[model samples]
Target: YINDVCRTLREEMKRAGIHAEVHAWQKHLASISRKLEYVPRQSNENPLSQLHDLVSFRILVDTDNECYLALGHIHALWRPKDGRIKDFIATPKLNGYQSLHTTVFCLHDCLAEIQIRTHDMQRTATYGIASFWYLKDRMGKEGSPNSWKLSYKEMVTWIEQLRQWQQELPESADEFVEAFKGDVFQDQIFVFTPKGEVKDLPRGSTPLDMAYRIHTDLGDHCAGARIITNMDESGCLVTRQVPLDYELKGGEIVALLTNPAVHPTRDWLHFARTNAARNKIRRYLKTYERESQQADASAPVPGCQTTTMTIHAQDRPGLFRDLTAIFADGGINIGSVSSTVQERSRAIISLSFHLPPSLKETLRALLHQIQALHEIEHVALEPHDDTF
Candidate 1:
């Protein structure tokens, strides 16, 4: 069942273009006796037939959006059981577990549970007894009774990091594990938010990095930060303003400051420590640049919003007067008009006009209006050229 679930999940993810590995596990049933009270494992009749959630699968994608994408694919493949779906991402657990969970009827009427979460959710590491319970649940190994001999926080941090690392690696590694990558979790420092909530970050991480880690919108609008100094006898916080590049020390309470005028520039890439921060800033800048270009394309050219219209029509006596009246009726002001009589009673007339802001978008309709006039053979609005 575990293997089949993994294969099916991977196939669906691949079809949906979601690049994430599915981790699956089955409850290993083994009979053990304290005094033979008759556990379910004691029976050889296969008790799993009566149980749901015997097989479970976990999928970790890059972003919260991808989590839902993968969830949609899973439900489309199998019918989910009613009242069995839980959305912890929208309302996270007390332990801050953010994932979408559902039980589905699958694989020949068997029931399987699926959990979909993003990779970022695991950054909030569990500590103490909670960590021990998690390790036991995932690895099936109970720690020594005196596991507190080492700092519980440090021990569990390493365990969680190691678990995530191991899950991410391929099946084979020719090189020694120590030589593969150095201890990434070792150089981390824990800082505090103004409200005393802890924020774990890498060593030498700046306040700007913390801003981004907290929320992308905060990072985008971040001007600088205020580092907490010692509190007064009244217990009020005393803080000193700091630059974005100021390195945050462990145990310091930092309050991020924002200004609407502030925006991420290329210089942010220089001091931004985390890859997540850098990536978000880059993404925002890219989107901003694209939108600016689109706006510029639609706007009139600065200083000279000159529009030229060329008309080739029959050289009737009232032709010039009728053409002038079109602009007057539409509340347009013609800057200049030039005409030349060509062969066989054909008149080539060119007119230049300055467009107002409100009528900028009506150029197409104006051209259609000119085309509807009598004796109009051909008419065209020339491409905008500032060099003219």
Candidate 2:
């Protein structure tokens, strides 16, 4: 069975475009004493049949994404036993173990347990996080990417939660367990983009939430979801438009549609399912809000030919340099410049500039030049009513 599983895994890896040398494959049989000791305690009607993990197989890869790819390949190859699939990667155990586990019917219709995890996860599972940290130190990769550091942080968070629970002192064990279920444990679903990349979202996440997860612009201009069905011979997708409020069931392939004319409305608050999404919508709405108290904060300067303009752009280094360079080329002096950066990494720059008679006549042309600068999204004269 070991030989058969190994050969099959190699073949599947090849089919999945995973080269031979990078991944690790291992198999083991439970020791007799351990199996004997485990069975009697469970008191199964038939101990022999109850032990599904007697023969265990492991496929260790490099990254969390590859773990899911391996899982897809394995499930495609074999029929998994009913109710045997467990996704520990999305929700790591209190001990920081992460894996994708499933029991499959292998050769001769015999049951075998398969565990898929990243190599780092396999190390943590085998020798705990300290050993992983030590191995990383030996390799001089302690600070590179530092994926294990995230696990360490999660461990610390769990310890802190435990301490908080102790201080709070739950009235009973049942209450403590309930608190754990409500706080520490969360229900999440995995969905795929039209391009097949998986995204883990909370159980009740809507398509609007998913759109925001993909990008702030995608969410800001989101029209609705286009549920991808399949591609035709011409390579165009056949998709059904779903409402932004539509709740997701795991495994749905979704494509968010956008309209440049569409923008967030107060109605969106009722549909948004994630705090990130809801907050982005609120920020966008407030930016163009007509009733905003600060709407006239940049009221026309007295005795000066000035124009108040607000430029919306993506936040990045050297962006101000490019913007200022454009105005300098136009030979215009900025009377005043202030910026408000939003939580979603968007920058709104309000610039008050002396509108010379020549510049005023060619204001549209000058604004066009500023708009052409990379990273700049919209350049609108302030105190104007405009949607996103």
Candidate 3:
């Protein structure tokens, strides 16, 4: 029965213009090493039987861009039910899986689940444990466990970067994974960032997952998020103070904010519901706790309030130096500065400083002057009332 089901699904995928490799396994087979080469070595028997009702399918591609192209192909071949198509290559699963997935009714009342992933992602999913072993075998003596470990670490880092990009762009992490899991893996959702990034999240994921996918720091310091959609031509999707638990949709972008003093709450762990988000929240809390302890050890008094200013500007040759000069000319002691360029053109600068009542006017004037520059868009003043 399972073999027949797998064959039928494979034929259907082919009829729909999707190329898929299918493998079948018998229960309790003896020394089935030959079968192992074709099969994933993991039992997919149930998914085969469940078809579209209980299980889905995923396709692995070669590049991040190809993932979306595959999604377009799937949707084009089979009319996607409203809200059934998802793109998660931009946003990955909590376990660091990335793919594009969808559920569609194929010919002859067969519901099919399709998953699309990059080649690298496909290997990661199928051989989660044996990836390193395979690498070692391929490289012979050079492919030692240590080499595999290094490769694994590099893969993890790449996934982390992708997760961060997904969070910053759109589609909560859970939604991205959910789309992949549900329709493809376990009934998941795939969302895209504003810049066409894909995220695979679980079904019913919230914006908080999006925040964490961007960075642990963003997730830990996350104060709120705004949802923007491609349909919103006026760009009025900036609904502020959005509830973290609000259900997210595909093609919507979420902008996340972080508050320096805000620590991750226990409720966040419950609400987040994704390994990536939960782990990030915990990491933030741990880091914050350690920093608090160190500060307590060094400080004469604790919990002093501080004030900071963040500036956003276009990337120009002298933008950083010019901004720093403004502060220097004002005789303001610079506490710290951090900046990141997005898409290689736009830049965001964050500066922290000790607030002196007398320097308030100087700071205001300096900010005003900076704002007057053609490259500068807006400046935000953040008061660190808890840290004096």
Which candidate number would show the highest lDDT if scored against the true structure?
2
TM-score to true structure, per model: 0.38, 0.47, 0.37
Query: What tens-digit string does per-residue lDDT give for candidate 1 at 55-141?
Result: 788887876668767876886677666445665554344454556777777787678888887644543332434665565455444
The runs of at least 3 residues in candidate 3 whose Cα sits more than 4 Å from the true structure, single-residue gaps closed, are 1-50, 53-61, 72-99, 105-111, 117-189, 202-204, 220-223, 226-242, 249-270, 275-388
**Which stretches in model 1 have alpha-carbon errors above 4 Å?**
1-186, 230-238, 306-388
Worst ten-residue run, lDDT, model 2?
20-29
Which digits, one per residue and each the tens of the lDDT, describe model 3 over residues 329-353? 9977666778888985889889876
**Number of clashing residue pairs in every model?**
0, 0, 44
- Global local distance difference test of model 1: 0.68
Model 2: residues >4 Å from true position, as ranges?
Answer: 1-10, 17-57, 62-65, 75-96, 100-114, 141-185, 228-239, 288-388
Highest TM-score: give the candidate number: 2
Ranking the candidates on TM-score from highest down gives: 2, 1, 3
Residue pairs in collision within model 2: none
Q: Candidate 1, 203: how far from true, in Å?
A: 1.0
CA lDDT, candidate 1, residue 13: 92
Weakest 10 consecutive residues of candidate 3 by summed lDDT? 230-239
Relative to the true structure, candidate 3 reaches a TM of 0.37
